[model samples]
Target: MIILGVDPGLTRCGVGVIEAGAHRRLSFVHVDVVRSSPDMSQDLRLLAIYNGLAAKIDRFAPDTVSIERVFAQENRNTVLGTAQAAGMAMLAAAQRGIPVALHTPTESKLAITGNGHALKPQMERMVARILGLNEPPTPADAADALAIAICHALRPAGALQGGEREQHLTPAQRQWAQAAQRSSGRGRRNADRGM
Candidate 1:
């Protein structure tokens, strides 16, 4: 499957394309910031991102798009810009009817490093190992994008999920699922101990 992973940003969007199959994963392509122009107005910047990403979508013809969930602690401006950039990226995918998946930083880190607490360097190493890269990617953005790709690639098809479903996954559902999984795992571990 051809998957396009995106790290969305107004001035420095990072993109990576990879193919996964039964045996191994291959990075058929990778991209970072189709263009970087700080002088552009906010609207122009968004449109630039939209247009540039549309071209990428045309070129890669990806079957699926994987995007990182925007996390904002203090900077509302950063969060909003990121969401806009992400929205444009999603629009590109949506226009083509391609599936789009969203992954949290923790989920991406866990998929790569077996731990959500993984450091950036650790994630870089994991991404390299998964893609068979001789060296880790620079700028961290590319590495993050690659990590997002790896998350979906490793997940079961359809189970990887698309952004369209994000609005429907309520807090109650999340809490229930988490609680169920934790209890199930705890039971399994206890059973193993008893045996």
Candidate 2:
């Protein structure tokens, strides 16, 4: 399976493509940082990101697109730009009917380095080791994209098929499922209390 992972940003969106083989093996196919000038108009910058991702989607014909889920931060502008780029990535995959999977940074880090709070250098090193590269992929964004893809690649087959077989889930999936359950449980509790 060919998977395209996107680390979205308006100024430097990182994209990584990998081919997943039998038995959880993964091979790197491509890595790039799509850049848009900060001086460019907002709409134009967005268009450039969209076009860049679309071209790659066309070139790779990825089976699935893995993208970093947008999270809130102190800088609202950064968050907005990131969310926009993420939307472009989703749009590019949607145009080709390719499924898109959103993975949180914590999830990716945990899957890649076995630590949800891993630092950037650690993630880069792990990603390099996993792909059998001589060195880590340059510019943190590129490595981050690859890590996201690896995280998705590591998921158990049953998880990919929409099965909730806890025993078949990887650590990342188990954590995500537990988090989801906790959030839903809170909602159920609130409903019970007539909130």
Candidate 3:
């Protein structure tokens, strides 16, 4: 399966594409950070994020798009920007009819590094080793994007199956499923409104 992972941020959104095969094998396809200057207008920054993600989706044609779920922070401004960036990612995926998954930072860390609270350096190292890269993907955000993809790639097939099987999902996976449902619902509502 080909998965595109996004680590969304106002200033620097990390994007990574990976191909996963059976037996837990994973290979990197692409990784980069989409940057917007802090001095730019908020609308322009968001536009850049949206366009960058859209272009990547078109170019890579991922089977699914996985984004890091936004979490509340003490700094409300930072949280708001992250949320907006994440929304851009979801919008791009939705526009293309690609399935989307939202994974929490802790969930991705645990999946990649075997610890929910793994440090950034440790997480980077693990991502590098898992993808067999000589070095970790540059910038912390890029590594994070790759980690999100790896997390979804490692999930059991049944976890993604709907209905009773979904009940067995871990808390993080359940959150992802709920977010995906909400996204699809919003798309339907937008279509109803002729958006």
- Report the number of the highest-lDDT candidate: 3
Cα deviation of 164, candidate 3, in Å = 14
* lDDT by candidate, in order shown: 0.74, 0.81, 0.82
TM-score of 1: 0.76
Better of 1 and 3 by TM-score: 3
Which wins on lDDT, candidate 1 or candidate 2? 2
lDDT of 2 by residue, 31-125 (tens): 99998999999999999999999999999998889888786652676888888899999888877767778777888888888889999998998
Give the TM-score of each candidate: 0.76, 0.80, 0.80
**How accurate locally is residue 67 in candidate 1, as Cα lDDT from 0 to 100?**
83
How do the residues 1-195 of candidate 1 rate in per-residue lDDT, one tens digit apiece?
Answer: 888888878788888888887765566467566554779888999999999888888898988888877755626767778888889988898788777777777778777788989998888887887887788876666778778878877754454322324423565774665577577664233222211
Tell me the TM-score of model 3. Answer: 0.80
Badly placed stretches (over 4 Å) of model 2 are 156-195
The count of residue-pair clashes in candidate 2 stands at: 0
Which residue window of length 10 is worst by lDDT in model 3? 186-195
